[model samples]
Target: MSNTMRILGAPNLYLQGPGAIERIADIVANLGKCALLVADPTVERMLTPQLTKLLTSVGVAFASAPLVGEVTPANVARLAGDHRADVVIAAGGGKGIDAGKAVSRAMSARLVTLPTAASNDGPTSRIFIFYDDDHKLLSAERVPRNPDAVIVDTQILAGAPRHLLVSGIGDALVKRYEAAQCVGAGRPNMFGGRATLAAVSLANVCEQVLREHAVDALAVAGSGKPDESFEKVIEACILLAGLGFEGSGLSIAHAMTRGLSALPATAEALHGRQVAYALLVQFVLENRSAAFMADQFAFYAAVGLPTSLAELGLPKPSADDLRTISSLTHKAPHTRNFERPLSEDELTEAMLQLEQMRQHSAG
Candidate 1:
C-alpha cells in the first residue's frame, strides 16, 4: 500500500521445520558445485555427518570455514580470497550466519542460510553484524546480496538449547512495535533504506502470531507437541520477522540493542537476549499506557525472556558505560528514527530502571 517505499528480500525460497536441510539439494540444484559450508567447530561437528551425507548424495562440491568468534571485515576478506567454494551455506546460530553472509558478500557467491537454532532473526536478513576480535561491536554491514534461500530444520532447532528458543520468541515480539512506529511516522526503510508496505505487513503478522502462539509454541519447542501456537511463533520469528526487518525497516528496539552491545556484559549475551531486554526500554521510552507495556512484560515472562537489565546480565552499567553507549549510538544510521530521541542520561536511566524492575520483581 505504501507505493512510496521499496520492498526487497531473499530472491528464491525459504523452508522451515525438521528435515528442511535435507531438501537443500532441490533448493540450489544448479547454482554451483563447490559449496562452502561456514560454521563454528561445535556446530560443524554436530552437523557435519548430516551435511556431508546430503552434499555427497547430491554430488555437490564442498569446502569449509571453521568459525571462531566475532566475525569481522577481515574474516570476510579472508573467505573471499581463499575459498574453493562457488556457493556459500551458512549454518548454525546467528554468529555463524553472520560470518557466512560476510563470505558470500565478499565472494559475490550465492548464499543459503540454514539455521540450527531459532535464537535470533539474523538468519534471514541482508545485514551482518561485525565485531572485533574481543567481540566488541564494530558495525553492521549490508550484504551485497540477500540470501538465496533460508533452510530451517526443526530437528536441528529442536536440539538447540531451550534458552535460545525462548530468546527467539523475545526477538519475535518486537516486529509489530517496530513496524507500527515506522509506519506511524510515515517513514519507510528497508535493508539499508528500501522499506515497503509488504514488509511492514510481514512484520505485523509475525508479531501478532508470536503473541498468540508464543506460550504454546515454546512449550512444543520445549517439548515435542505439534502445537499450532509453536508453529506460528517459529514461522514468525524465522520467516516473517526476518523479512520484515530486512525488507521493511528497523528502528529503536534494534538501535538500542546495537548501542547496548558496547557494554561488555551485554555484548556477551545472545542477540535475541539483548533485543528482548531493549524492547522493554523501548516500551518505557514510548510511554505506552500501563496496560500495553504490562502486556509486553507479561509476554516476556510467559516465554521466560529477560525483560530487565539484570536478567540480561548488565544490572549495573556504570555511567561511563552509559556514556560509551550513547557515543556509539549518536551517529548510528538507525538512531534518527527513535520516537523518543535518546540521550546518555536517558539511556542511563533506562538501564537503571531495568535493574529496578528486576529487583522489584525478585522481591
Candidate 2:
C-alpha cells in the first residue's frame, strides 16, 4: 500500500443562512480585536452602513477599504496601506473577497470572508488568484492557512444577479470530475499532499448538490428571497466546491482557464463561464461516453451555460489561435493531472472534436 500522507484544507468556521451577516461582529470579535473590511464599490454602497452598525454595536474597531479593479500585488498593498488590523473581513463578490485575501496576506492578519454572491468557490479556500491589468491570470497563491471564517448570507446571495448564480453552478458542477481525475492520477492536492477521503466526498457531494438544486435555485435567484434550493446551491458553490478543489486539486477543466484567459476573445469572460466551456473540452479529452456528454449538454442548455466555441465569443478561431491556446494549456502543471500526458496536438484536436460534437448535438 502506498503511504502518501493525505491532507484536507478548510476554513475554521463556516456559517450559511439568511441574515448570517448579522453574526459577523461576534465572529470577528472572537477572532481579533480590530478589523479591516474590504469590499467592491457596489457592496460598499449597499452594505457598508449595515456592517458598520453591527461592528459598532459590539465595539469592534474597524476600517473600510475599497476593492477596485483587478487583484494585483500593487493594488492589494495599496488597500492594506499601513493598516494593521488583526482580522480582515472580505465582503462582496469574488473579486472583493480575493482582494481581502491579498490584504490579509500582506498584513499577516486573520481572514473572514462574507461573500454576497456565489459566483465561485474562492471564499473557503486559501487560494487567492491574481490577474494582470488585461485580466489574464497571473498566479494563484495560498495563505499560510485558510480563512478564520466563511460567512455566507443567503439573503444577500439570492439578491444577486441570476447570471452570477448560474456561473457558480457551472463552476461547482465540475469539481467531482476534476477531483476524481486528480485522485485517480495519484496527484498531489493544492496543499501538495495526497487527497483525503473527506475531500473526495465533498467533491462528489458538491456536484450532486448542484445537479439537484441548481435549476430550482435559479428560478428563485435575483428575486431577493432565499429558499431551500437556493440555500443548498449556495453552500455547494461557496463551501463544498471550495474545499473540494483546494483539497483534491484541479485538472484539465481548470488548466484550460490559462489558455482561455490569454485570448482576447475569451479573456473578459467570467471565470466560471470559462470553466464551463473548458469542462466540455475536458470531457472531449477524456473521451466520455456519448450518453454522458448528451446529458451534460442538456444540463448546460437548461442552465444557460455556453456550449459552443462561438457562444464563448470565438466564432471562428484560426489555427494559430488553437495552437496558442493548446501550447499555454499544455504548460499548465495541472493539465498533467489527467489519466495520461496531454500533448498540444491532442489538446487542439479535442477542442475541434468538441466543436463537432456541439454541431451534432444542435443538429
**Residue-level lDDT tens digits of model 2 in 1-363:** 163989898999999999999999999999888898888888877877887899888988878888778898888988888677989999887798899999999999999999988999999998888998788889988788999999999988999999998888888888999999999998889988999999999999999988888899999999989999998999899888999999998999899988999999988778889899989999998889999999999999988898876888899989998998899999999998889998999999999999999999888
Deviation in angstroms for 296 in model 2? 0.7
**What is the C-alpha local distance difference test score of each model?**
0.75, 0.89
Considering only N, C-alpha and C atoms within 3 Å, which residue pairs clash in candidate 2? none
What is candidate 1's lDDT per residue for 93-128, written digit by digit as tens? 888898988888887888999887888888877888
Local error of candidate 1 at residue 89 (angstroms): 0.6
Q: Which stretches in model 2 have alpha-carbon errors above 4 Å?
A: 1-3
- TM-score, one value per model: 0.91, 0.98
